[model samples]
Target: MNREFIEKLENNPVIAAVKDDKGLEKALKTECEIIFILYGDICNISDIVERIKSAGKVAMVHMDLIAGLGSGKDVAVDYIKNTVKADGIITTKGSLIERANQLGMYTVLRYFVIDSMALVNIEKQDRHGIAQPDVIEILPGIVQPKIIKKINSISKVPVIAGGLISDREDVMNALNNGVLAVSSTNEAVWEL
Candidate 1:
């Protein structure tokens, strides 16, 4: 993991999550130090990453959302590392996290807490050494402070609250609950 990047997250917990070219441009103009790319195609991803880096911001790609990247984790990971040269990668697959780690790239494993079963699965995954991401991103961040607290207590890695973060209050709530950072697609929240 990049200690500097981690420190940056600590200093400014709001991460700009860009979903399109316009969003990317908007994110670069923000005070955010990190940007999570939730949109890109194989043809344009490298350019997008370059643009983010040129702006002196850390770029983290949501690997599963990229188009034309194919389904093979190894191939996508390798491309993101060697080609895009992104600061990190976000994914829901543990295997992808493991692969990205091996490649010397930062990894964020996204988990959707839709129900109680999902919470149990998170613990099970951690126990089995499958959830070994540098950071774990829990979705619907505002609605589950208790669950977030539970995960934070047991998780070895830092937790990032993401999804459904609509405003400054939501960001603050997540941070108050012990999340290392909050990823939001809402540009308005970027200012917070």
Candidate 2:
């Protein structure tokens, strides 16, 4: 993990998480504040890192989909440190956050809140075991203003709204509710 890159994202509010090479180009053209490259898509981590540096944008690796880490905590931590060179990590597990802190990497914990029950459970769990991350990516499934506020209330870390967000209104709704920024695979929202 690169401390400098993590600092860059913390400083910049908006970021674009691009899915492919095309999306990378689009994100660059859009002048997104930061760019996240999925670790699975990377055949050459060094090349990608160089491109990101050359473009003057913060680059992070998305390791949530990695085979081992997707299943459990131990493998997740191993892959997080060994498989990618990123400013930080994007994961859901509380254990991973703790491990990232140990590795001296910034953590971006993602929570998929499908309903109010899940939100409540997350808040409860957050209180006891998890160390606060540098950022939390909240995927509320449906972009509800109330849900956004609910997440904001419990989390001290900066909130980033993601998943199923389709337009500027949804983005505005998220931001209005206290999310520091938003992320999407959609190019339209990527421009925002």
Candidate 3:
């Protein structure tokens, strides 16, 4: 994890997770310092990233959602860095996170916490001495406080609460749970 990147996120906890053109436009007009580009393809992705950069915000492309990223391969990481020019990458695949890190790109590892077994992922990522991602984003953002505590206790990586983060109450709930930040596609939440 890059301390500088974490510092940036700490300064502004609301990250704009844009999945469409309207969302992107709204995000660029907000106070958000980080914009998670959740929509785009191999062709127009570069332009989308450029617009985010032009707005002077950190642009993080979610690899899996990008149509042309080829299932989150290392080469896809390369394309994002060398061609798309995004500030960071967000993915559920640890391998992609590792690859992005190797390229010196900020990486966010996303996880869907559906059950108590989410703790297994912490050990799994750490098993082979593999480095943890710069940040870990847990889906269904309204995860239980105890679950948040458990993850924080197990890993030092800053946690970002994403998915289903629709309003201020949800945002507050996540932040109060010890997450470093909250990412939401809801434009109103971005205002908060």
Candidate 4:
């Protein structure tokens, strides 16, 4: 649905997924244009998003991981958009993705590929307005190339690799398999 964000990741696939203050500090100094704020409570979430925004990087906060926020309602999405001022959100929940999309925020649907059902889930990602994912991030960046190829074939949206991405080889493997980008906590891989 969002071709612009897709293009941004395509140009610079290296993304910094920050889970702590140290990671955020380091992420600001890197070449990553997009930063995933995977940690933060309600108390400090705004400041965290502010810092990333001030640094001019797209800030995508993982809602499920953020503490002090209720996940059962659309208020959380409203808070993230209006209060936190994040560029977008990364979530596994379809409802949240729908809410975020309605708010005009950038949205990434994160999927953990554990089996064939997971692949089937990707194929089932349809347009119900809220069901749209600007891009889909598949976990375990080290999956088989055919699996990655299968994902690309089924998904109309761009795909990215995440989780357990340790080295350049893992990044290369995913990219070679046709993933548009790779997100990693490893700083060394960010330099790739």
Candidate 5:
């Protein structure tokens, strides 16, 4: 799964983050090769997955905020693979990221540099393949450039930029930072 998607991502570096069915069509039309549904309600997710497949792009579901999964990382991983039938998983928990790899599912780990504490934590770790997620989705606070650079510096896997990235410049900044891609629910990015 990772091998196949890596080849695709090597060629096209952006993923259209779609929140609903309406955006799926636009994402497909705009040639966004990958998609991630940010929510994890199973009934809703099943429908979204169908839409993603119909649009002919890979569909991934975020498990961190998924409803009903306990705080335990293992439970979250199990819920996504067994109950959700997601093509892949997105999460912040390193344990879940490792488990997803073991399950042979594409995993994207979402990390943030928002608070001073988070920044401090980031500095302490050599993030290279720590959780071993197939992709690392970095939250670009106010400074999109810094986020891009951070992704390029430590991540061995592909980097995907998310959060506070609203326009073409942000997307371009992320790509310029050696990011394999950027994901946004904003329909505007799709048009770009």
Candidate 6:
């Protein structure tokens, strides 16, 4: 991860995760320093990213959620780097995380921790050092303080609490528990 970018995240712990054009517009007008785009296609992803940049904020695309990008990691990474010019990318695939790191783009490896097995897998992945993403995003962050603490204890990478963060308290709870930041699609929460 870029140290400067990470610092920005630290200073502003609330990240706007937008899923549509309306969300993007609201995000652009908010106090958010980072925007995680969960919706877009090949035809408009670049435009959206550019718009975010023009507003002096960072834009991160969720590679897996983007339509028309297919499943090829290399192609998507290349496009995101060269065309979209996004500040970074968020993905659930370890391979893509590695590839994005190689391309010098910031990466957030998202993990949906629903059980002990998932927690064990995250530990194993961190230990093996196969795909060390710049940041690890734990989903359903609204109710996983223990899980978040566990991941933080074992991993050297910064953790981002994402998904289901609906209010200021949710954002504060994640940050108070040791996450570097919180990613939320809730426009109202972005101000926090």
Descending-lDDT candidate ranking? 4, 3, 6, 1, 5, 2
Q: Over the stretch 60-133, how does candidate 3's per-residue lDDT look in tens digits?
A: 99999999786657899999999999989999888898889989898898889997677788657755647578
Model 4 has a clash total of 0
Question: Ten-residue segment with the worst summed lDDT in candidate 6?
Answer: 139-148
* lDDT of each candidate versus the true structure: 0.87, 0.68, 0.89, 0.89, 0.70, 0.88
- Separately for all candidates shown, the number of backbone clashes (residues 3 or more apart, or on different chains) is 0, 0, 0, 0, 0, 0
For candidate 6, write residues 1-192 as lDDT tens digits: 568768888888889999999999999999898999999999999999999999999889999999987685687898899989998899989988888888888889998888888788788889899878888889888756787788899877898888889987888889999999999888889877
- Best candidate, lDDT-wise? 4
TM-score for each model: 0.95, 0.80, 0.96, 0.95, 0.82, 0.96
Which pairs clash in the backbone of model 3?
none
Q: Write the per-residue lDDT of candidate 4 for residues 1-192, one digit (tens) a residue.
A: 777788889888989999999999999999899999999999999999999989989999999899987564789999999999998999998888888988988888999999999987788775334478788999988889999999999888889999999999899999988999999999888888
Candidate 2 regions exceeding 4 Å error are 1-11, 39-43, 67-83
Q: lDDT for model 4, on a 0 to 1 scale?
A: 0.89
Better of 4 and 5 by lDDT: 4
lDDT of 5 by residue, 76-191 (tens): 67667766667788887878878888877888878786765654444443344456777777776235576557546655666677776688887777777677777788888766
Worst 10 residues of 3 by lDDT: 122-131
Higher-ranked by TM-score: 2 or 6: 6
TM-score of 5: 0.82
**Model 2: per-residue Cα lDDT over 1-192, one tens digit each:** 345544565466467877767777788777676776665443565466557757776666666654344664655555546665565667777777777778777677788877677677667756875656677888852467777777778866667877877788887787777777777777888766
State the TM-score for model 1: 0.95
List the candidate 4 regions with Cα displacement exceeding 4 Å.
Answer: 127-130
What clash pairs does model 1 have? none
